[model samples]
Target: MSAMLEVVGLDTCYGRTQVLWDIGFSVAEGRTVALIGSNGAGKTTVLNTICGILRPRKGQVIFEGKPITDIPAHHLVGMGLVQVPEGRELFSRMTVMENLELAAYARRDGAVDKDIRGVLERFPVLGKRRLQISGTLSGGEQQMLAIARGLIARPRLLLLDEPSWGLAPMVIDAVFDTIKAIQAEGTTILLVEQNATQALAVADEAYVLEHGRIVLGGTAESVAMNDEVTRVYLGGFNPRGQ
Candidate 1:
């Protein structure tokens, strides 16, 4: 598959506090690539830079062969690059269906309606609760709403940050299954996750970032089995977790 998104030497900051230091990674067409690290290791910052919430003071962000390093966030959305941030940010007062409708506003074409229908159909729970306010839903449902909302934009490359956060094992499993389903439908994904085991399980390739730098990368299995990773991210090489 061809490359859909690429970042070279990305450096991002917050005010005077520099967070990301010379980071770079890519997601190929139809592939799931994961960036896994402990909290505050710049995982979220990486997503922010890719989504244009934080502009990189250095380096390039190329999506679909177009340079979009400093482009406005809205323009990036129009280019089929959409992000589902951590914490499942949703319109609390809006119904599930209404929140999904917000994604259609960025469409450059007519697929938004179809995408909405597809998301609702894929997530019947959301369909059943379409009229229910997002804030009233359970944490799992809220996460679903967040992903569904991003899908409404018909994104070619979807950026997800810590998608499994604050959910039980069962709900996390459900979210992982949903992510796999979406990947099967040809959506390239850039995932940032703290759960190293699950991240390696679902991703085709993986990158390990430490202190805002790409420390290691390979087929998911390689990084998952790496000694350093087992020690830091997975707790020793005992193989208790798969």
Candidate 2:
């Protein structure tokens, strides 16, 4: 499959402090690619750069055969590159339906209501709480709303950052299951996750990041078996808890 998004020699910084160094990876069309590592490993930095939230000091971000390294973050959404950021980032005071509607602000289509219904159908919990304030929802529900909002934009490639953060194990399982369902629907994904075990289980390919650089890249299964990776990222346990 052709690559949907590719990052080459990416270097990003916050002021003079560089957060990423020569980072690179690609997400293939119709596949799930994961970037997994420990905290402060620059995993989120990579996603931010791809989403154009953080400008890369060097390197290129190629999406759909074109260089988007210089594009502004807001413009990328209309081009089908959408991000579900680390925090749910929901409008706390807005109704669930309102939050979803705002996500389509860049869209010119008149079928937004229909699209909203379609997306809400996938998360019946959100559908039930359509009129409630988003901030009032539980943690898992807020995350669901965040993802649902991203879908409202009709993304061709979804960048998911820490979808399971701060949730119960059961909720994390549900989140991963939802990700699989989304992928099966034909949307490619570039995921940044701290749960190496769960992330590898769902990813076809993965890159291991350490201190802002890619330290490992391979099929998820192979990376999972690496002694160092097992010790550092997987806590010496296999994906199935073996």
Best by lDDT: 2
TM-score of each: 0.94, 0.97
lDDT of 2 by residue, 35-56 (tens): 9999999988998899888999
**lDDT of each candidate versus the true structure:** 0.88, 0.92
Candidate 1 structure quality by residue, lDDT tens digits, 54-157: 88889998898988887988888878899999998899999998898876876667777788888999899999999998999999999999999888887899
lDDT of 2: 0.92
RMSD after CA superposition, every candidate: 1.8, 1.2
Clashes of each: 0, 0
Question: Which residue pairs show backbone clashes in model 2?
Answer: none
